[model samples]
Target chain A: MIGEWIRFGITCLLLIAALVGFTAAVIGAYRFGFVMNRLHAAGIGDTLGIFLVICAVSVSSGSFLEAAKAFLIIVFLWFTSPASSHFLSQIEYYTNPHLYRYVDRKIQDGPHSDEKEPE
Target chain B: MSVETAYDYLYTGALIWLSVLILFMLVRSIMGPRITDRLLAINMIGTLVISCIAVLSRLLDESYLIDAALIYAMISFVSVLILAMIYIPVRQTRGKFEKDARKEIRAERGIRGSVTESGSPEYKAGKEAEKPAYEKGNAGLDNGRDTQQDASLQEKGGSRT
Candidate 1:
């Protein structure tokens, strides 16, 4: 009974936190308006926020074994996200430089040309 | 809804918010100032997709989504490594060489240049913009015009090239 209650409480806390983090992330994306930087913020929501929620839910389950399985899955995700983001950021920093530029910077390309042509 | 049923609401709402955030990031990746920005956005998208699959799997009590997420992770990792392996060092040296050449040219000609920007993308684009129109649909026409213009400029200025 105590174990189940503990799991339940943790799960409730996890969900609340997840909701808060997700809300903040969405708002952050709206205000920032850049994809390259926004990607890191999303990773936080999906990996850290979602992982905590999953752990809370798994621990609260009726069957200890089922909860353990959920724990294993959460662990798997926790490890994978960083590995992916690390490589992606590095490769992007190197090879495909154009793909990384912001919208405002692209706009500069047009205005600069106009100023130079001297009509 | 009962306490048990409430999990579904919490989970779904969170997912919806997460998806919207990911979509906005995707838009950024599409219009990144440089290629790196887009690639990083894409990487972020991949990670978000995996997390989305994980959440759906838990909500529905399914296991297959985990496998799909794992595969996505592997593919994204390999793609980034391949891109970096080809791009980094060559540009590092080439960038320095270009800067030195520009300084020398400025000293000799003393054009007292109005715009001396190397980092700007338009500077690179302007090099391409020098090309002329190919009315015959052959790209060679633009190259031909730029070459002629360059030659005439050099001759008038007396052997600058």
Candidate 2:
């Protein structure tokens, strides 16, 4: 009986930690002014928040098959989040004409090579 | 309390909190300033909902719900990819009205032969220092070599510090 209680306590602790991760991600998203900063914040929830939630679920259930399935969700998200982030940033860079305002673009061997780098 | 009873309370509380987070994400999505911001918020919402589904799977002891969460993750990821793909082929202009605004500004100034490159809010904000660079970038874009232009731009990221 005590062992079961201990297990429950662990599961609860993990779930709360996961909730904290999600909360931090949301707060960071709001506090950051730049889209790239916001993306950095959202990544916390994408990777850490979801990982902890699955950890909690697996711990509480204690079934191998269920844990495997839940683990698959994490694996799938881990694979895709970076790809989406890349495409989004590329879109922002290519489409936003005001890009030079937010970020300092160091012109390389392009036609604009003669321009002094913004200090 | 018994173990089952304790687990039930915990799961219920978690579900409540997840619902609240989902609501917050919904508001963020609606208020996001740019397409990327909205998409980012929507992506976060998808992650939160997956957690909710996972918690529900445990609380209800329905094993199939874990499968459901897995499917949801796949769908959310694919949706983001599809949206990104839709934007890749369009002409790399900032806004639809930008070209019109440039023409009007040029006409007002009586610059008949000079080309009017794309303009954005920053241009209107009186930051003309970057206009030359912007024009050069536009020149490359107008050559119809989208892939080569993108490849050259990608090199800039190496020194994005």
Candidate 3:
């Protein structure tokens, strides 16, 4: 009985975290533009939060096969996030030098500062 | 969503925090000036993303997040290598450029182009000083060549006689 109660309590916690993460992601996306901050927010607001929620769901579902599937989705996302982000950043950095210009970064102290002077 | 266990709550809380962390990394990456700085931030984001999926799986009472984490790790590693390959040539070329510039400056100042040519890059070694060593070396080479010509002419003349 105690075990069952504990399980229920845990499920509630996972649901709440998921709700928060999802909310944060949406907010970040809305405020920062889909590509600008969506990926960033997803890193923490979606991916990590989702992982926690999945664990909770798996344990609660009490089905090995179903739980495994949830775990797999989380795993897939985990692997893809870094690879995609790296590639995205590389593309932005090399092909589109304009990202720096639009990002509001302070290049004053950087080596590129010399080039930053009013053209 | 019957999260009926301590694992559920712990996993949920963990996921929330992971998402928070990944967001930070993402911002860092976007703001970075250098390639590696962005890459490092991206790497951190990937790790956090992996962690997020893992936690989300628990919260959602599923088990798919693990696969995502593994894939993220593999892909990120490969991507970083690609970035390095793209920039390596640029770095090498700049090094060569600096060497060439210094060489030209040294030559202008009456110094040798390379350290192997002699020593020191002190280019402004005084204008047109006409060093004794320069005259001596030129004179020696000229004298040797003249002697060789004279000997050859003398040898030809004696043969004809």
Instruction: Give the best candidate by lDDT.
Output: 2
Which scores better on TM-score, 1 or 3? 1
TM of each candidate vs. truth: 0.53, 0.71, 0.38
Residue lDDT tens for model 1, A1-119: 56645554676687667656655654554344344455576567656665665565555444566556556656765676576556556554444323312322344354333211111
The true-versus-predicted C-alpha distance at residue B99 of model 3, in Å, is 23
Give the candidate order by descending lDDT.
2, 1, 3
DockQ of predicted candidate 1: 0.22
DockQ of each: 0.22, 0.40, 0.06
TM-scores for chain A over all candidates: 0.61, 0.82, 0.68
Q: Candidate 3: where is the Cα deviation over 4 Å? A: A33-38, A102-105, A109-119, B1-161
Docking class of 3: incorrect
Candidate 2 segments whose C-alpha is farther than 4 A from its true place: A105-119, B90-161
Estimate, for each residue in B57-158, the C-alpha lDDT of model 3 and write its tens digit.
Answer: 556644555566556656765766676566545433443543454345435532332332222224214211322232233343442354345435645765
CAPRI-wise, candidate 2 is acceptable
Ranking by TM-score: 2, 1, 3
lDDT of 2 by residue, B57-104 (tens): 989999899999999998998898888887764676565434554445
